[model samples]
Target: MGYGELIIRSYDPQYDRTRVEDFERKCEVGPAKRVFLFTDTLGDPICRIRNSPIYKMLVAELGNQLVGVIQGSIKLVTVHKPPNDLAKVGYILGLRVSSLYRRRGIGSSLVIKLEEWFIANDVDYAYMATEKDNKASVKLFVDRLSYVKFQTPTILVNPVSHRMSRISSNVELAKLKVEEAEAIYRKFMSSTEFFPIDIGNILRNKLSLGTWAAYPRGESWSGVPSSWAMLSVWNSGELFKLRLGNAPLSCLMYTKSSRLIEKLVPCVKLPCIPDFFRPFGFYFIYGVYREGPLSGKLVRTLCRFVHNMASKSKDCKVIVTEVGGSDTSRLHIPHWKSLSCPEDLWCIKALKNEKKNSLHELTKTPPTRALFVDPREV
Candidate 1:
């Protein structure tokens, strides 16, 4: 595709939906032979980014076909500085190019156009996340686009079992009212990197199932627990379906035998892996904030609580969450090593260096608080 023939414009849902979906189907994500991942936007290509305060989707057209698409959203987020030091940060995601038009600069053109929009909006910085092993993506962003590798977060995935995992009786879990949740988050997470300033809106969003806190039993209800953990669940499955492809024979057998054993013996407590070969939805755990000396236990209990809740849902096959590689809470969150990825790369670029914190300073600074993974970006 020639640069002159390619036209980049804002996506129009009326005529672009079907074409976008078609292009998505033709494009394969993830590594060959290891995993083939499919992301179903459930008919709305923009559903994932629509929840952000400011979002836009753009499409690249070569003649009559939608060959490429990219989405970007801007939000006021806390940076690696003093508490409440907020900056206009833009997030880039859902970049796709048609398989037939590879290496012809469609992907690059789409991203360049999106970054232009981010700069025009006065975005201080922009970042994106992708699998560390995605060489093409790494080259496009890190080498070609001048983005720096900032953070390597792990995607923690725990399969929702048929049987519920038990939480310790010593831990007391309570659902926090919207106001209560908002107040707690504002107090504790304001210093965390990428912490949204409009967290009140996130907690109150309809997709936010709710927020819950877990602490030791017999703690005073009025006061904060000495050792406690809090998290909010977002109904991401409602917006997209993730399908696992290229399953190995061993995995297939394990899933089958586990199901058969469960059917034959009702009392058996086998860890049954759900049928992931088909399309399935998932719950995203965000705002994984904890404090106190015994917060690890509280984090595990909260994870089990979310697991039990997911077991009741027909479509929810797995519980997924991401935390920084250095985040200590990763030691407590329950996840299968085989299913979870150890590193998801985040590449960032400074749109402008007029601010007090330069791009180099931001990259060199060590994270002081746990990363607050914004659910809207998930």
Candidate 2:
């Protein structure tokens, strides 16, 4: 059938089972595997939608068959804290189209529909990402729809063994209490790009742990300043790591959820956001202070702590982080070599009252004041 014959619609409760099965069969290759599996296993995509400040899901249908699906949500980019006068920017994620329906403008139509949804929801700008090698997707987003490439950050996955190798004799690591880690996290924020985090809220919502400095033997300090790591374990048995560092820097937290039974077999129970949501592994929530002589060392130390922890845990396999597209000073780190690239797919659309320049600049210009907010918030 021709592209015009296809119909697009939002996810419906009635179509759950059939659509999930269809998606599983269609998404056998490419980046669509996880998304397909998520939908199939969950049985209902709508249930996984995250209750964020703004949320949306759109799908394309060809007659009675499902042809394409697009899901997106709105988030406050607290990193920039743009003036309230400016329109709120939202992110578009979990967009997928079936392979059989290629070159038919189905994806583009879904994007346009999503843009309308954004406008109705009072969102000013929207953004999405695709792999650098996926020229077809790049063209669909960047060329046809005019979605600019915002931040392309590299994605890295470390086998458990790789994380273990980084634990050298020079450093000592220990788990810290949440309260102790929060105080140190506040200090770390003075130099990094991070949204203000609520320690209490984090402890309540998910499984979490903190790891901190043991104080190296040569340092003759009477009291050690608090420095640590923080990790949030999701329902899916995936661990998300974040770091907080002071002068004597260290990892802040490490958290992992235990698996649950599904159909008599153990299965990782991921956080219950909407099926359309994209799942990120780990986050680099804090950055090093540029002015300090030890800033570079601090960054390296934080990376090492993460590497060490991941090496020990077989379940924690991937580390996803975001760095400022504009920041050049602390760009190079030895451990970051395995990361894919520093660019991500950010889908965007212009609004009627919104200044084109604002949308244009966000997409074209490299962000200078970028901070890593927890993806859970997105």
Candidate 3:
């Protein structure tokens, strides 16, 4: 029990509707940050989360008042420890505590319970991401709890109104079958962190627009992807249509007039809205990766093509992707740097004894510069 006798228990839709809405209302991020990930098939806020069998949700209640919430999902991932070990890791997210409930130890209780679940599920590692500048979050996870500030990733967003860059003649942007997509992912993501063991499910999900692979025109599809990039596009219109969660004045104006207005106004910096707060008509691009010599150029081409395709839809106003801060791929993305939020921090800790002792070794390793944080998982 925490302050005011707080209680930690499973989330029940029937009783937690008002509480859930209140929690969602208090939070300031979206796509994943705005929308709760563990909702039911139809995305009914009150229904139980059935996104996957491995997912679970928890809520903290005090005096019959819901105050905090957290969710966890297990993924069998391959870590590059040496030859690559297939380890089950838990991705913890959707954490929110009402402003009235801070300093009550509700958050700590939730993480402890989730880490227990990870251990029971044979999860070796546990991790979650937050805005890097949130001092409260950083202190709670890193200083108060036994966690390490692992990786910082930039969340890239692009307004899709402009024309897209054309792919080079030698590069072919082809839409591939689920089988082809999975084959490429299995190879390119073998040494990646938090890689899904059941990538097939991801590729075939109902929301997935489709899986795409980019390669040289001369190459034939087969075992390994030589100079390549792959990504799955998710239609983000539903979430926005249901809950128009963006600021009213989101734009990409870079005219001389705009500069003059900014110069005249000392308080106003370049306007870049948050991803979840942006208005409707955007594609949340996920599971993106590039491999090869000209991978950067090729990947950029593929991304532009996707943006162009999405732009044709009246509902799609922007294209978004979250890439690790240290990932080489971020170099190629033409994102609104002034508008994007601060880097997202993914703080981590270990649950199993084998992983707990090896935490030091894991930290010493080259550090996972890039890993596919499936947008859907968020």
Candidate 4:
């Protein structure tokens, strides 16, 4: 059958089992495993894409034969803050065309159809992510769909090797309590656009794994301070772990699948600026502080804490983080590099409404500045 003969439809409960199974088979990766890892079904990851509420599942059928499938969702651009117009953005999650139908434009057709749905639902911009190594997929997004390069994130891997790298010591790294951490975070980020790190969100979302502060050890601060936090998920033999910590100065974040420490050691062994960069692990740092001595120390200690945690997980391979528009300097850390550019879902309609047409390039935007989008409503 031809592409036009195929049909793309919204998700139906009757097709959930079939769709999930087909996705598992087409990818040679189980949906259950993928969903679980992304959602931390057994628990919660520091940051999760699977937890988004607005998933739209689409399937392509040729006279009843399931030839391909694509999943997309509407999300609020949460990273951006106020004074910037708030808008709903669309993200294409899982787009799979069967191997036999590879050359066909099934994926493209699916995206167009998805865009229609997005437009009808009042979405202004659509985005999707593909592995850096997937040239074909990248071409599909860029050349065919007119989707500009949104973000380029470097994917790093660390293979599991020695025990020392996997375990965390009770060594008192930084002595600041939760309150102190929050205070430092707030002060440093006073000029930026970030959610006030409330203790409630942290407790409710379980966001406190790697948080450390610079305040005197015993002093109690009122709430969770505003500091950079790193989130991670580990996939290893008989163990899966998710961790989050407040980043002080500098940290490394990358993605991997397995044998994380061993694979990362080679990169660490390279001549680098900081001796602490010599560790094997895969995870991404969402943000890191570059100014102030206290903040710098906090960032370094947090990086070390995350490294130690990864050393313990046997199944993890990849770690990913979304860096801010202003903080490209962190990407220069010897062990770290630019994975992708900061591509966000911007609304031309909103800009036009506000009588502003031109916007700065992603690289030119300050890292601390962000446009916040709440995914729940999207």
Largest TM-score belongs to which candidate? 1
Model 4 agreement with the true structure over 136-176: per-residue lDDT tens digits: 77678777776665444332322323333321232224434
Reference-based lDDT, residue 162, model 2 = 34
What candidate 2 gets wrong by more than 4 Å, as runs, is: 1-5, 21-25, 28-51, 79-87, 166-204, 207-291, 326-339, 345-347, 361-366
The reply for model 1, stretches above 4 Å from the true place, is 1-4, 82-84, 266-269, 355-357
Query: Which 10 consecutive positions of candidate 2 have the poorest summed lDDT?
Result: 247-256
Report residue 327 deviation for candidate 4 (angstroms). Answer: 3.3
Superposition error at 80 for model 1 (Å): 2.3
lDDT for each residue of candidate 3 in 209-257, tens digit (9 for 90 to 100): 8978788888875755588877788775554332233333423233444
Model 3: how far residue 219 lies from native, Å: 6.0
> 304 in model 2: Cα distance from truth in Å?
3.0
Clashing residue pairs in candidate 3 are 29-33, 29-34, 30-34, 153-325, 246-277, 272-339, 281-315, 281-316, 281-317
RMSD of each: 1.8, 10.9, 5.9, 9.8
Off by over 4 Å in 3: 1-4, 30-43, 46-50, 82-84, 162-170, 216-226, 236-281, 368-370
Candidate order, lDDT descending? 1, 3, 2, 4
Q: Tens-digit lDDT track for model 2 on 41-111?
A: 23445332453445667778776667777777665443323322334555665567777877878888988
- Assess the local accuracy of residue 78 in candidate 3 as a C-alpha lDDT between 0 and 100: 68
Better of 2 and 3 by TM-score: 3
TM-scores, in order shown? 0.95, 0.65, 0.80, 0.58
